[model samples]
Target: MELVVARIGRAHGIKGEVTVEVRTDEPEVRLAPGAVLATDPPGTGPLTIETGRVHSGRLLLRFSGVADRSAAEALRNTLLIAEVDPQETPEDPEEYYDHQLIDLDVVTRDGTEVGRITEISHLPYQDLLVVARPGGGEVLIPFVHEIVPEIDLAEQRAVIDPPPGLLEEPPGVDGADGADGAEDGRR
Candidate 1:
C-alpha cells in the first residue's frame, strides 16, 4: 500500500531545495533524510530525501542529484509515495490514514443508507469525507467525531450522525421548497 507522503512545491532557492506540502502524519519517518520514495507519473522518482526541515510551517527538502533550481522546479506537483504496511495504524487511534477511510459504507445511526466514502479531503482546519451518494451525487461530510461517530473497519462502514439539512436540500434555496408566493399566499 503506497501512501503519498508529500508533493513537491516550488523551488525555494537557486539550490535544489524545494518546498513540500506534507501529506503524511509520520513525516519524521516517511519524509526523513535518506528515505527513498516512489513518484507518481511512473518514472520521475525513486527520489531520496537528502535533507528535510520545517521553514515557516512548510516542509522543505532537498534530493540527491537534484542540485540546481531548475531541477527542483521541474519536480513541482510530483507526489512522493511511500510503501506502508496495511496492518500499521497510527499511534493515536483518532488519527487515520486516507486508505482506511475511503470506500467505507456511510449510513445513519438508524441504518438509513447515506453514501459511500470515495475520498478524504484534507484541509488546514479539518478533514472531509467525499461521499458518493446512491442517488448519483456527492456530499462532503465533515469528518469529525461528533458527526461521524463510528468507524467500523471490520464491517467496512462509517456511521454518521448528520445534522439537519446535511443530507437534505435546503428548504428555501432557489425556491426549492416550491412555495414561490409570499407567506400570506397572495402572490
Candidate 2:
C-alpha cells in the first residue's frame, strides 16, 4: 500500500533543504535519511532523502541530487509517498492510518446511514472525514472521539454521535430563522 507521508513546502535555506508538512505518524521510519519517496507529480521523484533535520519546529529535508534553493523550491507542494505493507498496523490500536478509514461506511449512533468515507483531511489542529452523502452531497465530519465514537474495522463502519446540527445544514446566525437571519426585510 502507498501512503502519503508528507508534502514539500518552501525551501528552507540556500541549500537544497525544503520544509515538509508531515502527514504520517511514523515519520522517523518513513521520512528518515536514506528513504526513497515517490512524488505526486510522478516524474519529479523517487527522491532519496539525503538528510533530515528539524528547524523552527518544521521538518527540513535535503534530497539527493537537489543541491540548491531552486531545486528545493521546485519540490514545493509535491506530495511524498511511501510504500508499506498492507497488513501493517499502527502500534496503538486507538490510532488508525488514513488508508484504513477511507471507504468505511458511516452511520449515526441510531444506525441511520449517513455516508461513505471518501477522504481524510489532516489539518494542523484536527482531522476531518469527508463523507459522500447518500442524497448526493458531501459533509465534513470532525474525526474526534466525541463525534466519532467507534470505528469498527472488522465491520467496516464508523459510528458517529454527531451534535444536533452536525449532520444537517447550518442554521441561521444571530438567532434568526433564515439564512440571512431576518424574518422581515429589515437588516
Candidate 3:
C-alpha cells in the first residue's frame, strides 16, 4: 500500500533543505534518514532522504543530490509517498491508518446511524473524520477518544458518543435560529 507521508514546502535554506508538512503519525519511522519517497508529479523523485531536522516546529528534509535552494524549491507542494505492507499495522493498537478508518459505519452509542467515514482530515491540532451522511450531506466528526469511543475493525463500525449538538446543524439554518437559552431576545 502506498501512503502519503508528507508534502514538500518551500526551501528552508540555501543548502537544499525543504520544509515538509507531515501527514503520517510516525514521521521518525516513515520520514527518517535514508528513506526513499516517491513524489507526486511522478518524475521528480524517488528522492532519498539524506538528513532530517526540526526547525522552529517544522520538519526540514535534505534530499540526496538536491544541492541548492532552486532544486529544493522545485519540489514544493509535491507529496511524498511511502510504501507499506498491507498486513502491517501500527505499533500502537489504538492507532489506525486512514485506510482502515475509511468506509467504516459511524453510529451513536444508542445505535443511531450517523454516516460512513469518507476521509480523514489531518490538521495540526487533531484529525477530523469526514462522514458522508445517509440522507446526503457531510459532517466532520473530530476523531478523538472522547468523541469516538470505539473502533470495531471486525464489526466495520465506529461507535461515537457525540456531545449534545455535535451532530446538529449550525445556527440559522433551515429556520434554526439557535435559540437555546436566549429565548427572550437576550444576547
**C-alpha lDDT of all candidate models, in order:** 0.91, 0.92, 0.94
Model 2 off-target regions past 4 Å? 172-187
Query: Candidate 2's residue-wise lDDT over 1-187, tens digit each?
Result: 9999999999988989999999987899999999999999998999999999998899999999999999999899999999988888899999899999999999998999999999999888999999999988789999999999999999999999999888886556335566673566766
Compared with the true structure, the alpha-carbon lDDT of candidate 2 equals 0.92
The list of candidate 3 runs beyond 4 A from truth reads: 173-187
Poorest stretch of ten by lDDT in candidate 1: 169-178
Best by TM-score: 3
lDDT of 1 at 14: 92
TM-scores for all candidates?
0.88, 0.88, 0.90
Q: How many residue pairs clash in each candidate?
A: 0, 0, 0
Q: Tell me the spans in candidate 1 whose CA falls farther than 4 Å from its real position.
A: 170-187
Better of 1 and 3 by TM-score: 3
User: So what's the TM-score on candidate 3?
Assistant: 0.90
- Candidate structures ordered by lDDT, highest first: 3, 2, 1
Pairs that collide, model 1: none
Q: Give candidate 1's TM-score.
A: 0.88
